[model samples]
Target: MKKLELTAQAEDLMKSHSLQGFPNEICGFFYGKTVEGVKHVTVIKPVVNAKEGDQRRRFAIDPLDYMKAEQFVIAEGLEFLGIYHTHPLHPAIPSEHDLKQALPSFSYIILSVQPEKVVDITSWTLNDDRAFEQEEIISNRNVNTSANKAS
Candidate 1:
């Protein structure tokens, strides 16, 4: 199975973001480097949930936000590892909409968020057959000293 190394700081920030956006889904980008087949998340860039109407059930990152995130990742010399989003009041399992929107070569980190806290977190990746497969999340306390960029 593929692995993702999440720093403690990143996890904390994700939790905070989820709570702040509780009742609505939040979206963001994960920036890091992939070494030895493991993706190490060093930075998380939160973006506005640009979806129209029912934000409680969906999230859409604006094209401009994507472009800016890409620019930031390039400037920081990091890979655009994947996307992170909250599933308000739901489990971390991907929905059919999520599966349809997933892309190959990118990880999807889903946070199950309640009104007051995050209930769960899970990482997923797309397989060759275009199906979602769970990835192992290895929590690393030591943040990446070399990559200090965060937003």
Candidate 2:
């Protein structure tokens, strides 16, 4: 599995956003650069959970927001690394619905929000067999200083 390094600020933003949405699943996109097969998340952007049904159990980001995020990341010279969402009262693991819609090369970050608290955070990448495999997340908040300057 590839490693994911996230900035302290990015993680904090995720946690805070998840908490604010409390009991309901909130989602967003993470922007970053990937070097040597490792993804370094530098920024986290919170977006609306444009889901139709039960938000507490499921989350869906608006398509327009996705497009806007892509443009923003491109403008910032960062890659659209992946999306992050809170699993209210659930484990920080991808559910079946998540698996069904999972992107192969993109990262899926899940935050377990329990009782208005961010309990756990885990990153995942889909495998060849169509299953979610956990990706090791390293706290490298300071590593982005020079690592982000790339062609």
Candidate 3:
């Protein structure tokens, strides 16, 4: 399976956001450009954030911000590479509900906050059967480095 390279800051942000979204799901996207030699897989996110949602954690992007994000990515030469979400009281694995809603081309990242003490994050690549195939995350903490560039 392919591995994902995430920045340490990105990982911590994801954990904190997941913990904060404690009873519901929290979602967002990743943005970055490809580092040479990484090819299509090199695209990564320097930043990640939670989208607005109700108390239940059901969220949809702010229409204006969504459009702006698309525009920003295009203008900045970044890719809308993956989608991330937190499972407040669940495991760091995709649920049946998640599989049903997942889009094939995008990577599905799940952050589980069941422990209440810390958040556990995992990535999955879905197949035709809607099963989540486990993947890896390589966390980068250095700035001004090409470690997690998106393609």
Q: Which candidate should be chosen as best, given TM-score against the real structure?
A: 1
Report the C-alpha lDDT of model 2 over 42-127, residue by residue, as the tens digit: 77778888999889988887788888877887798989889899888889989889998898889999999888579899999988
Q: Sort all candidates by TM-score, best to worst.
A: 1, 2, 3
lDDT of 3 at 83: 71
Per lDDT, the best of the predicted structures is 1
Clashes of 2: 0
Of 2 and 3, which scores higher on TM-score? 2
Task: Show model 1 residue runs off by greater than 4 Å.
Answer: 144-151
**Model 2 local distance difference test score:** 0.84
- Candidate 3 weakest ten by summed lDDT: 37-46
Query: Candidate 2: which stretches are off by over 4 Å?
Result: 143-151
lDDT (tens digit, per residue) of candidate 3 on 1-151: 6666777666666666666656766666666654542213333332333345454545444556557658867997877667777766667787776777777756777777774745578888777776788777776677432334221
In model 3, where do residues sit more than 4 Å from their true spots? 34-59, 62-65, 128-130, 143-151
lDDT of candidate 1 over 48-143, digit per residue (tens): 899999999999989988998789778979899999999999999999999999999999999999889898999999999999999999999977
Taken over the whole model, the C-alpha lDDT of each candidate is 0.90, 0.84, 0.62
Could you tally the backbone clashes for each prediction? Answer: 0, 0, 8
